[model samples]
Target: MSKPKVIVIGAGIMGLATAWQLAKKGANVTVLEQSAVPNPVGSSVDDHRLIRYPYGDKPGFVAMVRQAFGAWDEMWADLGERHYHESGTLVFGGPNTPRAKVQADVLATQGIDVEWLSPAQLVRDYPLLMLDDLDGGFRLPTGGTLRCGRIVAALYRHLTFQGMDIRPFTQVKDVDPVTASVTLADGSKLTADKIVIAAGAWLTKLLPDMASRVTPSRQIVIYVRPPAGTADAWRKMPCLLDIDGGNNGFYLVPPTPGTGLKIGDHIFSRQGDPSAERIVAKAEAQAILDKCAGRFRNHGDYRIIEGKACFYTVEPDEKLLIEARDKALILSPCSGHGFKFGSIVGTRAADVVMGAADAEQVRRWATGEAP
Candidate 1:
């Protein structure tokens, strides 16, 4: 029997990973991208993205994370290198910390190692933080960061080397889900046996019906240099999730190899034009700096290095949306914490395409409901 032909729209992490998996499974795969494979405009680009096992209240998500890690391990084996940094993550509670505390407690019930630290211990052990006003936090040893840009690039190279067609700079004008065909910007149509739309924030434009369920959210991540004396401490600092600032509280990714210290909040604007030029206004950027000033110790010593704007199609509950419609599967594997699970989501998509799993099962698996 001949291998099936597959068409994947958008070359983000999800698309690339899916393509890589299908190719490995002996499917003829072709990936389309509006930008380069490592397009900075897409949600997957950055110096680093945080990946961990502690998902505050969602044990289902935590369960799925285990599978995600395994998927990444498989990718590492195939790529002949690893793009992950195993830095432990520390999460502090804010006014909303009670909810996070509940999440941490649930994680403990699942046999995940969690170490609660007192104020004194926090100060003594992690002096780079200003934990004075916070209630308390815990350490989850399984979490860390991924070199996302490198991973995407590696997948592209791997897929291309495997004889999968990767079409960069090729914009997809329209897609016929029922027919499993794509109409390109140049008015050309390409048909395939299976179609997967992993188009991140651009999902709405391609499928107007998904506009309400999956919204394009404009998010920001800023990289900074630690205060003068705390450089070493910052470098060694594990990823931090400050739950104290309520919605404004941000997650911090420490500087690891090939990356810098990054700060971003889980808050989603749920508004933005992905095609518009990314312009970070002075006041908008300053607000983030000011927010960080209130959260971090020695804020004055930190120097603003870069501010980047990225987009993601977010579901209301922030779950991964992997729905098979007609002949296509629409994938939104990111809300804020999606990068860590990219490898698994991609593999799952391949499974769905190859009839190894159904769409509903993939959704349940993504939410940690299925084994």
Candidate 2:
């Protein structure tokens, strides 16, 4: 009997990871990308992304993170190199802020270790932060950072070496979810036993019905170089989420492994054309720069390295959409926080396609219904 033939759209982290998983289960896999592999326009093409156990108020996500970390460990073993940095995470807020405590409570339910710190302890432990007004926070050592772009590149090379067909610069014009086929821009057709659409921001273009639920949010993040005397402190810093601080709260990714410190807000703009130019406007860029001024110490001494504009398909509640539509699987596991779970999602999708798992269970897990 011939193996099942599978075709995956998009070469982002999710797409490549799905194709890799399918191929591992003896399926003939082919990945099609409209641009080169690791396209900068895709949401997964960033230098680094944060991975941690803190889920704020969403407790279901805490369980999902445990599974995600396990999946990444498997990927790291297969790739023959670890792309993860275990820098821990520090979430700070005032006593009125309940997110830090909520994360600790949820994580404790799973027997994970957590340390609660008072305002004085927080300042003493991480002196680089300006937390004079903050009350307290929690620390979880399980959190870390992922070198995202490097992982994608490694996946591409590994998949090709394993004999999976990867076709880049091939634009897909139309898709038939019922037939498990797609039409190329040049009027060519390709059909497969199963089709997986993991197209990131471009996912809505193929599935118009999801346009309302999954919106493309144009978000911006700036990279910066810490001041002369603070290099040592910044290098030893953990992933910081200032949920109870100024500018409505922002996430800070410290300069790990010689990478630049990155700063971005958690709020989604919920607007932007994924196909439009991604150039950061002067005013928009300045807003982010100004936000950093109040949050970081020696802000004026830090150099603004670069400003980036990227789009993510954000659902209203920010739960991932991983339902099967006809013969196609719509896998837009995105909402700014999806890249961390790329490997696990791929394994689940492949299991469903191969009849090893139930589609409903997968949907429930993706939506945080049945963790």
Candidate 3:
């Protein structure tokens, strides 16, 4: 596999990151993107994506996150710019605390400290919160936001500088796994030593066999401007997550230096066409504001700056779905939590393609079962 020629589909974070890693490993990689490198409809093209230590019942991801951070650090070094902001995380253990407690225990094993916030403290400190909960929560210094859009752009530039071929607006119609070739919408074909289908939400279109295994999800996130009364709190607010058992609660990313205040729920719509126009309905915007307004002060007057819709590939069990398909590999580090692991997903997969890593090991690791 020395200097293998590879063809990568999709130019989102995962796709571009894979190309970057592949180029680093001396592979001649050609990346075909349906849209621009920083595709606006991409799940990774957001103002910010969150990374927190508390993974609820999925403790394996807690350790995997450590590797993700390391990978990000390496990318930052290569780009000479750090696109992450450590705002910490404020957790609210709603009526359900079992999953929250498991998260706490997992963090404890890693020597991460959690400062418990009593009910009285919640009332005194975060005046922005409604604090209807009967009990208390904690604040861990291990969560933050990654500048997603910036990272994508930087990776694209980095790959280009490395002499990698990245073609945007090149739609891939189908793939020939046996010969490791990709058929374009224009009837042009390109062959390579290996093929990568990291097409995020549109993965099923390229690999119909994965339709039952991965469902495209339509998720919305709204950027808002807080009233002057709570502007300070909103500006200083750490990335917050409320542990509400199975029913997904809201996760808020506070404003960073050049970012907006973002709020999105963890629930998956499980219904969307990635090729369809992204229209964020008024009801959709209201739904998010309504669910999160109760958690903040000066909510009624807060103005919705913008509402954007992104699509994600979700699996039934909520773990990453990275599998091998003859000469092609399908990478889905998503289920609403993919962007955070973009760098590592590319690194591990590229290593496998370069014959530097074990394929089954990467799959197992992505499933959160790697030791």
Which one is best on TM-score?
A: 2
- In candidate 1, which residue pairs get closer than 3 Å at backbone N, Cα or C atoms, i.e. clash? 56-103, 94-243, 94-244
* Cα lDDT listed for each candidate: 0.83, 0.84, 0.85
Error of 2 at 156 (Å): 0.3
Higher-scoring candidate on lDDT, 1 or 2: 2
Question: Which scores higher on TM-score, 1 or 2?
Answer: 2
* Model 3: lDDT of residue 235: 78
lDDT of 1 by residue, 235-286 (tens): 8888876655366677788888667888886678999999999987756655
Model 3, span 108-227: residue lDDT tens: 887776887778886787887788663777787777999999999998888888778899999999998889998899999999999988999999998898898999998888998888
Give the TM-score of each candidate. Answer: 0.96, 0.96, 0.96
Model 2, 135-211: lDDT tens per residue?
A: 87778777878999999999999999887899999888899989999999999999999999988998878778888
Those runs of model 3 whose alpha carbons end farther than 4 Å from true positions after fitting are 94-96, 132-134, 246-248
Q: List the residue pairs that clash in candidate 3.
A: none
The worst-scoring run of ten residues by lDDT in candidate 2 lies at 241-250
